[model samples]
Target: MTIATHIPLPQPLASLRRRAPGTVAGVDWALLSDSEARRLREFGLDEGVEVELLHAGRFGSGPVAARIGRMTVTFRRHIARAIHVQPV
Candidate 1:
């Protein structure tokens, strides 16, 4: 008998801190509220977007500073965790 296992997906954007920038693989829409997801999409944070981790907030694991497209956006750690990314 063969056991089936699932391959893990890419890590979340939040985990990219201190690492090189990555491309936005996808977002956990279910993890975000409708309005929140919508807002993020409006900000051009949807799938296939290229994101670079600029820096973290003063406090540890606080807001994440990232560059998405041509704009820079800061996201809470939780929100950053909701974004799946593939490191470049």
Candidate 2:
């Protein structure tokens, strides 16, 4: 049997700012609330889905702009923090 190594841990979506644009990642639903999770799902931010950080709102790290699937969505910094993501 071959050995498996180097599994990356999930990171908060809020941390995506440091990453470059077009960086695709998957969401972690375990960190979100029922309603918040549902809302995100409606916006197509479900787990395993690919998301790219388009841009961050100007002034004080406000909202984060990202492209989920074919649609673009924005979320507050706090909310984004609650959502964990792993690079895809």
Candidate 3:
């Protein structure tokens, strides 16, 4: 789907700053895993889903929050670096 609102959040989260996760919670994040990347197209993390930034650490340290569908996945900042989301 599309992010219903516009938030001045950081990067990818700008569209998902204040949304809720749905069902595909464990889908990690596109910015995190390469091993899982190729398989992403087959999952719900596809284009129609909304991803939000729940929480982030200092300078990309610790774990960050990405709302993918119904789950808010806490991912490592390094993981997020690998993901690339275009403005929609």
Per-model lDDT: 0.83, 0.67, 0.50
Between 1 and 3, whose TM-score is larger?
A: 1
Candidates by lDDT, descending order: 1, 2, 3
Q: Which candidate order results from sorting by TM-score in descending order? A: 1, 2, 3
| TM-score, prediction 2 | 0.65
Model 3 over residues 1-88: C-alpha lDDT tens digits? 8879763322443223334432222333545556656545444565446566677766546776776666656655665544444433
Residue 80, candidate 3: Cα error in Å is 1.1
Q: How does residue 24 of candidate 1 score in lDDT?
A: 87
RMSD of each candidate? 4.5, 4.1, 7.8
The per-residue C-alpha lDDT of model 3 at residue 62 equals 76
For residues 1-88, what per-residue lDDT tens digits would candidate 2 score against the true structure?
Answer: 9998885666766666443432225455676678877898688665677666677666647998777778878887767776667754
Model 2: residue 3 alpha-carbon error in angstroms:
7.6
- What's the CA RMSD of model 2 in angstroms? 4.1
